[model samples]
Target: MSSIYIHIPFCKQACHYCDFHFSTSMGKKDAMIQALIRELELRKDEFRDEVVDCIYFGGGTPSVLETEEITLLIQTVYTHYQVTTDPEITLEANPDDLSEAKIEALHASPINRLSIGVQSFFEEDLKLMNRAHNATEALQCIMLSRKRFQNISIDLIYGIPEMSTARWIQNIEQALALDVPHISAYALTVEPKTALEKFIKKGIIPPVEDEVAQAHHAILVERLEAEGYHNYEFSNFGKPGAFSQNNTAYWEGKSYIGIGPGAHSYDGKRRAWNVSNNPRYIKAISQDMLPQDVEELTLTDQYNEYVMTRLRTQKGVSLSEVQTLFGDKMHRYLLQQAQSHIEAHFLFQEADRLYVTKKGKFLSDGIAADLFMLNLFQHPFDQNSNQS
Candidate 1:
């Protein structure tokens, strides 16, 4: 099934660790919303034959928008394209923006799922991340949201500088106590040019250690699994029937359309992304133009992506599918490359599928990279011969 991702590129404020494309200004909010609708209309033909099963509102913080604005966007999608009867429409939000009135308004809208960005439940962590919500607000928003929404997901951050194991455990416990159906937890990464990186470089904040993150992740898996939450993905934990349909579609390589600036779309063989600059996007869409770049994926590129995305999930990689899709040579290469990791107990094979061991979950990216083909050679069975 296909999905639609609508990017709301405005936020109340910037978080110290975020490098996502967004602005703190609301001057262009109305224009941006119009532009998004226009873009969706312009791209309706792309999904004319597909049924949209999920419509995800992701962004700097989708909750910042008025409830009517969100409903208008959803209606626009319905007006322009075919949608499933019971589509999973999700809105990514922040705790500070989800007041009692706001939650009630959102519940009345088409949004059936809430992915709240409650990065931490501690005062010190909140201040460090510059999260808009205080600890109390974070706790209270989830309580309020649970009253109206059943499909709720909360974000939690680990590996904060000076955050002890006890504190990290406390954060997870707080989330478990909230009893949300899904939890997307991530390590605090220091992206280049972000405030977090600058602070660490200047000794204002201590450096984030990989060791700390690894330890926290182990604890997270053990604790969550014991509580009946499946670590379906490396950074995602969900109770049964609570996994994100939008995200699951993405991971499974289903086609999707991305509306708005700094958004991306994939159609199995090609990928496209809108310009990150909001003004440029609005100007282009006003003229009935798509301000995006497109690229066709080569055979090697597709194989690498398959390994990367599938390996990150519990399903792992299917050896038979690899041979069928990428041919016997590539399949053999994968098995050869995976031999060392398999022997080291970082990965294991059961039947025809290969999965990362618990010891290698934190380093899954690196392990997937090791299996990537570098386009250094061309096989006779390769279909995209132009790249060769």
Candidate 2:
């Protein structure tokens, strides 16, 4: 199924570890929204042959906008595309923005899912991450959101510098106790030029230990699985029937249109992305231009993309499907690349499917890269746009 992703690039505050495409100031908010609407109009034909099944309002922080602004954006999508009757519309929000009035407004609005960025449930961790919301608001918003929104997902981070295993367990237990349907947990990595990286460089923050993160991941997988949450994706856990349709469709390589500054879109053969600079993006869109770079994927490029995305999921890579879509040469190349990992017990092929073992889940990215045909093509985009 096809989808639409609108990136709202304004945030209340920048988290210490985040290097996403977002502006801390909202001075260009109005212009950006108009640009987003115009982008949707311009890219309408990309999905004309397919009806939209999901619309994701991801950000800087989508909840930073007023409810009316959110409605206007969704209305623009409906005006430009053939949306399903019950589209899975998700708004990426921060706890501080979801006041009682705001939640009530969203209940009346068309948004069906709320992906709150509640990175941690402890006050110290919140401060360490520079998250705008306090620990109380983290719990409070989820409690309040449950009253109106059932399809809710909370984003959490583990392996903070000195964060204890008990605290990590507390974070997971808190999320489970809230009965949130989906949980997207990630390890804390000190990205280059980010505050976390600088702090670590200056001995202000301790470096992230791989062992700590692995242990945390192990606890997360085991505990969440016992709690009936499926480890559907490497970083995501969801209850049965509560998986994210928008993300699942994306992971499976479906066509999607991405609007707003810094958003990326894929249309089967090629990928395109908007400019990261807010002012530049607004100026170009105002002149009726799509301020983005587009790349045409070669056969090898497509095969590598398939391997990276497919390997991260529970399904792994299907050898038969690979042969059908990518040809015998590519299929043989993949098998050749995977043999070493299978020998290491990091990967196993059962029947026609290749799956990552529990021992290899935390190292999935490196493992996927190990299987990549890097000599085929250059990496796409500036590496800064890694977050979804």
Model 2, range 1-388, lDDT digits (tens) per residue? 9999999999988899999899989888898889888988988888888899999999889999999999999999999899889999999999999999999999999999999999999999999899999999999999999999999999999999999999999999999899999999999998889998888999988899999999999999999999999999999999998999998988899998889888999977999999999999999999999999999986666877898888889988999888878666667777888899999999999999999999988888898898787754343322221221
Q: For candidate 1, lDDT tens digit of each residue in 1-388?
A: 9999999999999999999999999999999999999999999999999999999999988999999999999999999999999999999999999999999999999999999999899999999999888999999999999999999999999999999999999999999999999999999999999999999999999999999999999999999999999999999999999999987888778899999999999988999999999999999999999999999998888888899999999999999888877877788889999999999999999999999999999999999999998873644436743332
Per-model TM-score versus the true fold: 0.98, 0.96
Residue 86 error, candidate 2, Å: 0.9
- CA lDDT of every candidate: 0.94, 0.90
Worst ten in a row by lDDT for model 1: 379-388
Best by lDDT: 1
